[model samples]
Target: MEEKSGDSLATVLVAGAANLTIALAKLVAGLIGGSAAMLSEAAHSAADTVTELLLLVSVRRSGKPPDERHPFGYGKAGFFWAMMAAVATLVGGAGFSVTHGVHEISHGEELGNLTPSYVVLAVSFVIEGVSLSKALSQLRAAAGRHRIRPLRLVRITSDTALKAVLFEDAAALVGLVIAAIGLLGSQWSGSALWDGAASVAIGLLLLVVALILIQSNLSLLIGQAAPRQVETGIRAVLLAQPEVEEVVELLTMMIGPGSIMVAAKIDFCDEAGAAGVEIACDEVDRRLRDRFPGVNLVFLDPTPTRRS
Candidate 1:
């Protein structure tokens, strides 16, 4: 678990650093070039920098050891911070991009210096790609351990920190492309409308990504069930034991990133005594913890077999 948290922190830090660097560059270029799309991109990158900082806080706080006050540990703290970051992205990245674009459309100004805008965008793209690639590589390795694909890992993996960074960086890359297109189109046609439109497009893209991240974080905060495969595997592992007769119910929740809590009502064999049942329960816990990295806790409600 510590290792997982470490990896998440590392990913977030890489993205955060890259975003901060680009934010400053974009701010300068936008000011110098006076392009609406470039300015919107600058605001977008600045918002991303804050989101990364918040995600950094989430990863660090979530790694704190469990205490009496919060027995489950500070794991869910990441989810809360992730939620805050999503809101920030929506307001700072999306809201401003759209509103600024509309305002620029009517009051378009001549782009003063296209050279700085072009250079800054190119540099931002390469850096953002590097950061995004690192995150994806980590996700790919994790997906391998889970026997799933990278895309599925992004969707189903309980690591909220990685998920947030990956999605945000991807949106950033796309936004850059849109900004570049807008700049080029406006320069070609000698009208600021194209640049303004590009800003709107970037805003809409960020909005969609932010909403998705919000939903994911909200679900985690509200308590999401483990994946279907995990539940099935747990059920199978229990029933395979000789002392176990039937599994009445199995419930799983992601208490934190890669930390799962499993509770099940299990019926042991009819001849199994209390002592034997205890042994069975212990064995079940052992097997589950061994089989799944996420199965941090197991609660088996031992029930006698009812003769129907």
Candidate 2:
């Protein structure tokens, strides 16, 4: 848990720093170019920057030790802040972009020189790509550690901050292309409506990303199950142990990003005593935590089998 937590924090910090620079560059280009689409892009970048900051807060808060007020510790903090970041993206990025685009379209403002916008968009694309690469690299390392494929790992892991950075950077790259196209089209056709249309499209794109993130956060907050494969692996290990006879029930829940709580009911050998059971349970707990990075907490109940 310590190693994984540290890596996650590092990834989010890099993303946040990258977005900060991207946002400032876009803001300058938007003002100089006076294009609705470019201005919307600026707002979008700013929203992403804020999203990274919120993720950082979530990571920090969630790392706190368990307390009486919150018996399960501060794990859920990640989901709460992740949900807030999604909402911020919707309002700060999509809302302003669409509304401002509509206003500009209705009022028809002439777009000034687009050279600065073009230069900045190109630079932003490169920077965003770099950040996306960093996030992807970390995710890939995580997948490798778990011996799972990339897509499947992403589906099962509770790394909301990493997911946010990957998807947001992808969206940012796409939005930049759309903005550039809008500017070029408007310049060639001598109509500012193209720029407004592009801004609206960028807003719609942000809406889609925000909705996905919101749904993911809601599911995690509500408590999701671990992967089927993880459950199967655990059951196999328990059954293979010499002290165990049967695994009556196995349950698992994702209590936080990269954190799972596991419970099991087992029937041990007829001759095994209390001392033997304790040793077996401790061994199993250590094995599970070592083999599966997500299995941070495990509880075992050894009960006698009822005769028919």
- Considering every candidate listed, which one attains the maximal lDDT? 1
Residue-pair clashes per candidate: 0, 0
Question: TM-scores of the models, in the given order?
Answer: 0.97, 0.93
Instruction: Write model 2 residue lDDT over 114-196, tens digit each, in one string.
Output: 99999999998899889889888988898788777877766666888888887898899899999999999899998989999
Judging by TM-score against the true structure, name the best candidate: 1
Q: How many clashes does the backbone of model 1 have?
A: 0
Question: Residue 23 error for model 2, in Å?
Answer: 1.7
Candidate 1 residue-wise lDDT at 201: 95
Cα miss at 70, model 1 (Å)? 1.2
Error of 2 at 59 (Å): 1.1
lDDT (C-alpha) at residue 10 in model 1? 89
Candidate 1 backbone collisions, by pair? none
Compared with the true structure, model 2 gives a TM-score of 0.93
